[model samples]
Target: MKGVVILGESECSVKDFPDPVPDVGEVRVKMMATGICGSDLHLYHMDKQQAKKRGERIPGHEPCGIVDAVGNGVKKVKEGNRVTIGHWLGCGYCDQCAAGNIMWCEERRGYGGAIDGSHADYVIANERNCVLMPDSMSFIDGAFIACPGGTAYSSMKKLDVRIGDTVAVFGLGPVGLSGVILAKAMGGKVIGVDIIKERTELAKKLGADAVVNAKEDDPVKVIRDFTGGKGTPLAFEASGSAKGRTDIVSSLCRGGKAVFVGAGSSENVINPGQLIGSQLTLMGSFVIPLWMTWEMVDFISTQDITFEGAVTHRFSIDKASEAYRIFDEGKTGKVVFEWS
Candidate 1:
């Protein structure tokens, strides 16, 4: 089997490796589509020590595929069934797992980050992590459900977005756009903000009530002004930038809640006085629970949200490196690795 291996910064190659066999309770999935995520790009240009720590890595996390073979004890899915595996394979027996927060399990392992991910033709997946895909969704679209969809869903649930409430998303990337759709579906008046005009326009198409061009205007003031000077009751900071984090905090009304969803930054400096005085609640969200992921899949099947538009670029497994380059340059929406 052919697979991708990172040689160093800005370097990757197709290396031949032995095809994997499913272990007990595991299933072998024939790769159909895999997404190039933002974190994968960050890991690509790791400064020496970081590179050494993640030496000889295969980078891809948003994977969707069909079951090719099943190991003994696998029964939820059988051969020839299409499915999307959850990115995090958490211990199902842990206390966190009992509370439906499997992503925080002590034995948590991600498909693409900790081990070999789906940047190739085949991947071994635990049967417990698989989510059955609706007949209406394509494999490429299903790829987005694994990570971006799940993460966005988790963030929305964490904030408990109410119907008729107001929301401002501080980025217009794939995850941010997903937030716009989810917020609107929950009956919230959605406002999207981004420096990129193209992304902001896409947010409008996705049902955002207003769009703010961060480069041309002050986002916090503009959002507040648009919201009748009261600011949005809820805000989602989906850009992993210091400026984005600051803007989200400043654009909140008294007692407003903000959720931080994007990754790629290490440190965020925020004001304690403002938080204390405003009585604002700030929450950081990560991966969604398996049950929540299933709910998201059901919503996608019934709602107007479509992952087709979110995926703007496609490449074969061999061009994985080029796909990563395009993602790193921020020139595309969701670049997917399409396997035949």
Candidate 2:
């Protein structure tokens, strides 16, 4: 088996390793497609010493593939089944695990982070973590659902975006782009904000009603004026920057709701007074729960949503370094590695 390993300072390589075999209740998937997420870039940019700490761990979580083998206790997933493995693995008996919120489990292990991930030809996963892909969904679409798409779906569910509602999405990265697509499908008028022109343009192509170049205009004022001085009824923050976080809160109409899904910055950007004055409902969302992953698959299928439009680049695993380089530039939509 060959897997991609981060070599620090924006370098990566495909190295050979022994093929992974599944244990009880586990399954091994032959990777068909996987995505390079924003979180993966954090590992890609790590210093030499920091990267060394990762050892042989492969770094990718968004995976979609065919089941190649199953362990002794595996029942629901059989060899040859198409599936997308949820990135979080947890102790099976915990309440959180039972509810499919494996990421909240006390003993949770995340693929590509705490364990060897799916950036390889073969990756292992618990059977419970594998969600079957519909016949109509492409492997790349399934891969998106495993992470960014699912994250946006979770946030949208939290916001309960209604028809005709104005949704201001801060940050036009993959997750934010997914938000625009999903919000538009759910009938919200989307306003996308990003400092990069390329990203803002991509958002428009993906169905955003309007886009704001934050470097040229105040996003809050733009959103407010766009909404006729009321601001948006809903907002999603996926930039993970301090300014983005602050702007999202300020861009919402009074009594409106917003959900934060991006992770990176540590700055204190919230103003309690504003929250009190506007009577806003601010929530934070992580990746989708395992149960919701199945629901998301169904939602995409029933709504006829197409995520392929969000993908801008694709490469073979052998070109892992090049893939990471382009994605790190932060101008593209979504970068993926596909296998035939």
**Best-performing candidate as measured by TM-score:** 2
lDDT of 2 by residue, 1-340 (tens): 8899989988889999999989998999999999999999999999988999888799999999999999998989999999988999999889999999999999999999999998999999999899998888899889989999999999999999999999999989999999999999999999999999999999999999999999999999999999999988899999999999999999889998999988989998999999999999999999999999999999998888988999999999998989999999989999999999
C-alpha lDDT (0 to 100) for residue 128 of candidate 2: 87
C-alpha lDDT values of all predictions: 0.82, 0.93
Task: Give Cα distance to truth, residue 237, candidate 2, Å.
Answer: 0.3
The TM-score values for the models, in the order shown, are 0.93, 0.98
Question: Which residue pairs show backbone clashes in model 2?
Answer: none
lDDT of 1 at 92: 78
Given candidate 2, what's the lDDT at residue 117?
Answer: 92
Clashes in predicted model 2? 0
Query: Model 2: runs farther than 4 Å from truth?
Result: none
The worst-scoring run of ten residues by lDDT in candidate 2 lies at: 47-56
